[model samples]
Target: METRFLKWAEILDFLILIGSSVTLVAWIFGVPLFYHADGPVLSIFTSISLLVIVSLRLATRHFQLWPFTANLAFLMIVGGGNISSILMLLSAPAVHINPKSTLVMTSISTSIGLIFFSFYEILLYLRRTPNRFWILDDILIHLALVPGGLSLIGHIFQNPNYLSMSIDPRVGISLLEMAFMALLALSTVLSNPNLFLWKFLKSGTANQLIFVGLFVNQYIAPIIYLVLMHDDWKSGDFGPELFIFFGGVIATLGFLLFQAKLEENNSLIRSGIN
Candidate 1:
């Protein structure tokens, strides 16, 4: 199942690459299709970052396409691209580079996510043995997810508050950028099926229970809670703090349920083995 899932993820990554490439081309050619008349437009930097990371990911899929040094070089290239993007955004206004351009400035979340992802990949490449190093990878992945996930939620809820966490007050994430950043993040995580959640999932014990627990906690429950509170959220009656509090509660409960289910499944597996 893990192998099949990874295969599908690769295919999805390819499609994302093609879409991002098209968007980049449109940006270069001044195509209006991807441009919004009065809304956030996808930045050239975001498009380029998407293409680089997605291509790097697909290129290194099996780790057979490149040697260790080559992979490191590519990772450096990825890091450089993001840093250059940050510099460009910061300096664009000062230099008056296409001051009337419709493209939105790249959000800090997008750049930081890519940087953390690069670090995650580098750690994977350099690890001599699994050990607790994978915990570090897990930490990086989650940290990467934090900003990108906030951008996604901000877009989903049409709230500017969630989008302005970038260093530049003017920078905001577009729907396109947020969506692909999310897909790229997920693709990055899926690239290594031997780590973290993937490892537990590949264990093939309590698949249903695990799936249900995560779905409810991560998706169904929070979504429902947010939906119930969205009107108040918009009216200033509800704030992010409350949202975070409830979300933590839900997550804790879900974790307990998931643990219990996993234990039950283990007992069954043990009995069957006997």
Candidate 2:
């Protein structure tokens, strides 16, 4: 029964992705939103990128085409592509998608990626499904993201200033990334799931190397961009929402990790006593 429900939930997620792609394509066709003025390609590529991620997920259920790295690559493509989009909106003279629309894209894309990530863990990795913990991800998607995403889609169609907005105000959320894999992939996989990567990476040094690389690329690189190099910072604009979002996520993740560790230690104690 639990497996049955997950299937339906996955289908709904796919449908939402499809609907969003269709809407985004239509909007771009009507009013092209380019990543660069000299190069008008990214607008179209966004939809293509979305399709590719979905297709990859469908094609590899058994970890056939490389289990660990595949999804990370997909996320890199998605995150790397969309990360700069917020900055485009924050730049002066307002040359990118409207702040309202940008906010929508941020919420939708992040929410979708997180939903997929959580589902992958719940359905494939976790031993228990449909637990009380599942409600956390559900709240993120249903309560906050879905409504905002729907509103953005509706607003894009009606606004005359569709791709135009004032970047004159120095206030906009900087995009921030948090990669648990970089921080604790080893801990997560080696927990109750007892999962591990291919044998080649199971060795101590190799895993450490990968962890360091991912930490630098996924966590450190983005922090540098958001803080020092981003246009928003250069323009003296800063929105506290993204910081709040980042903070809440990190705090929750920390608490969860602590709980998992405590549980594991308690289990070992029980086993020893028996």
Candidate 3:
């Protein structure tokens, strides 16, 4: 599952670029579908940032084609991050359909995360040993996920507080921004087998169990629950907390069953070895 997914990173990057580009076009032409009627507008700068970030990834993937590709990509990543930081500190708003719109804190943080990843990619291009950087890679990717994950949960629960890192409610992240950032970080991490995350997904029973549990709990089970319970949820049969509780129950039960099977297999292997 991991290998197959990672192999498509370049393709995924293109898809993301296309999606972000659509959002840009929508913003330029005042398309209602791209922005919330009652919420913050997706900043044009944000869309442009998405394009640049993904383009940098694609460029790094083929750095050998151009001798300056890595250097240029690294400079752009660092430059973008620095510019975002300056804007963040100044409390300046990014260019958007709404003139009052401010940059979401997650956008700034995501730039920083990418800067680190770009640096790592540079080292890889230089043919450095990857084993020494696994821990750093894991830390950086998880840190990158924090804001994006929070924004996603915020959207799911209809909570504005999770949508931004600022005290000002006007500053919020769009769903597209969060989605792209999360997918980019995850795909980039998985694309490199030497990363701790990829290594964990491929080996021991315990590691596999954790990966399965997280996948089910965070993704599959919630999606199933949401689809099946949409009518009830829409009619106010239960709250978000209840939805989360039941989804977690389903994930936990599935995880326990898988755990039992894994333990049985391990025991058989031990006996055979003995």
Model 2 regions lying over 4 Å from their true place: 31-50, 62-72, 86-255
Instruction: Report residue 269 deviation for candidate 3 (angstroms).
Output: 24
The window of 10 residues in a row where model 1 has the poorest summed lDDT is: 128-137
Candidates 1 and 2 compared by lDDT, better number: 1
Q: Each model's TM-score, in the order given? A: 0.70, 0.39, 0.61
Summed backbone clashes in each candidate are: 0, 0, 0
lDDT per residue (tens digit) for residues 1-274 in model 1: 6687688779778978998888888877878334654345567767776776667667776557555677778777877777776677666644423435555566656777778877777777787325222255655665665565555555566556665522333455667766776677677666666554555555577964765565345434545667887656562233653466346445644554465456556767888953
lDDT for 185 (candidate 3): 73
In model 2, state the lDDT of residue 131: 30
- Weakest 10 consecutive residues of candidate 3 by summed lDDT: 95-104
Each prediction's Cα RMSD?
5.9, 14.5, 8.1
In order, candidate lDDTs are 0.62, 0.38, 0.56
Report the Cα lDDT for candidate 1.
0.62
Cα lDDT tens digits, model 2, 6-117, are 4553454465346446646765556533232221122333344445554454445435755655665666665556545545544532444443342233322333444444
lDDT value, residue 162 of candidate 2: 17
Q: Arrange candidates, best TM-score first.
A: 1, 3, 2
